[model samples]
Target: MPTTTGMKGGGYYDANSKEQRSASDAFLPWLEEAIAALPEPASHQQSWNFLDIGSSEGANAIYTMNRLVEIVRRQSDLPVWALFDDLPTNDFNQMFLNLFPASTPALSATDVYTAAIGGSAFGRLVPPQSLHLATTFNAIGFYETRPAARLPHFILAMHPNPGAPREGVEVSTSELIPFQKQAHQDLCHFYAARAAELVPGGKLLVQVFGRNETQSTGHGLMDVLNDALLDFVEADMLPRSFYEAFVFPAYYRNIDELMAPIREEPELAAAYRIEHAESRDVPVPFNTAFASTGDRETWSHSYISFLRAFSEPVLTAALPQDLPQENTIEKIYQRMERLLIDHPERYEFHFISIAALLTRL
Candidate 1:
């Protein structure tokens, strides 16, 4: 009955502690823009608290606080406050504490707490009607699927390397994926609860990752990496231990698969009127600016970094059990490098970052 999807290996947010912070920096402007789009409270000049849910490493929280303070200072008001909350496992508390030392007061008052969201079990991280604005950047959606075409490949990816047998690892290709229904349900549930917590007419901005219905570019790259992973696992390139401990749950959902949970919550669905769903072509190197850059190599590297960051679980699960487990980060990096080198023509790396905005009813 845990609230999270119970994904094994590291969840996307858990991978490469360094990368989590980096990604947050990249997301800051988009997030600030999203927040700015929200209908301001009746007392826009009055200080109000903003909540950053699922805040990883609290970078977005810090960045958001900084921006909010700037906006408020223009009017000569007290600085805004921010609360950064995430599941205990996210380990963002210590990371942010280190980044913004306690002795150093923020431009606005800031606090961080451990909390799980989007589940049947709710944590009282923020009181009802207490927050003027709430947001989650790219980490709120933990979804699943049961597609026949993808399941087989996913099952192979789930096969643990030899000698590492656990119940979770004993996944059957014949059985459907676990926790799909519950995870989706929890997401919607959390969305609704978050809506209720917002002050009446308060804004909730969720910058979740999504796919373009019109194009297959994002889905295609995910399929390629996942399919290649399946081949590697089935070929015994990776041991069973690796799959069970790491890969099966990563890259487990296509865009549709992941969003299924969010779209199901009627209350959460009704609480917001979607204002915009925008898709911007984020070139390969993932220009932090994303607007000015057009270099192909930069685009390629950006895509590669994304594949590595977003597909952490998949890579870990496909690792051969026979390999040294803990010291395998560099080894896995080498493996990916070899794959790209081995099949230069087979790889096509391109991606887009999708953004959505919704208003709290």
Candidate 2:
């Protein structure tokens, strides 16, 4: 197993990210308007560039990039150069396989050329003032580096995190300052980097899994994993240190954190003009399917698969070196699947997000 940093690659992420797609779908209208409002290019301009940052398995990335390509086609015959960027640990080969023109016959004669780059989205990757339109979906909540927060026993740093492995080991809001500051810094870098790459009047659509007034993504369901793993530690099946050490290297930003850069940082404030911003809940496909059909087996599998797609790599990296890697990973997820299948109410993954459309100034 590779010590990777992002989503599980080699086709796993491609198949299981329906919830992400649904989130992107909610922004479809914003996408269309943003594309429609593109400023006319100078007479010397040669072609257009469309970039999707943090594009995991290329499925959702391709969906949006293809749409951008299609809409641009209606406006002109300029060839489109599409770029997908993510962490080097991500599965680039799998991304390319799905992005190839042959694999997507509909895009064959569209004069769209696709390429992938591996790097931090918080860092500059392309030439300054070069891109026409750029986007990121269901990303940017990830911490550039996991904060040294003092969550002694939990899967995440969110409020209402599980208290287990040790009674009275609760993390107070004040104790989570490192995580809060880290998120602010990450967002600062993210906007600044993207600002340097986008041209004047370019549209930047950023939609990320985050916190709203009532709901926060990765909260309740993460608690389920916590309780199940705490059981493992109690039974001596896994060490307590694993629970103490494992925390998702992410922070779900509330609206305040989302706008911190704009309010506090001059670089971000002077670089772009915000066109639209929102924070709301989006429907989860598996959850919706269960609500309508009450299919425990199918919904449980889909829910667990979706979880495993993104979390498996990080969870695997947290395992003790002596354990059988594959077997232990399977056991952990298998246990969660059984838990969800038996008590559907135990699993609550609310899909809430903060999205915005900004134009480069």
Residue-wise C-alpha lDDT for candidate 2, range 57-78, written one tens digit per residue: 7988888787887788878888
RMSD of each: 7.9, 2.6
- Cα shift from native, residue 189, model 2 (Å): 0.5
Best by lDDT: 2
Q: Which parts of model 1 have CA positions greater than 4 angstroms off?
A: 1-46, 101-124, 144-150, 155-186, 214-228, 231-266, 284-329, 342-345
Best by TM-score: 2
- Model 1 global lDDT (CA atoms, 0 to 1): 0.48
TM-score of each: 0.63, 0.93
Per residue, candidate 1 scores C-alpha lDDT tens digits across 34-96 of 555544554653556677676655544565566755654444444455566655555544435
C-alpha lDDT of all candidate models, in order: 0.48, 0.80
The candidate 2 region of ten consecutive residues with least summed lDDT is 161-170
TM-score of 1: 0.63
Pairs in steric clash, model 2: none
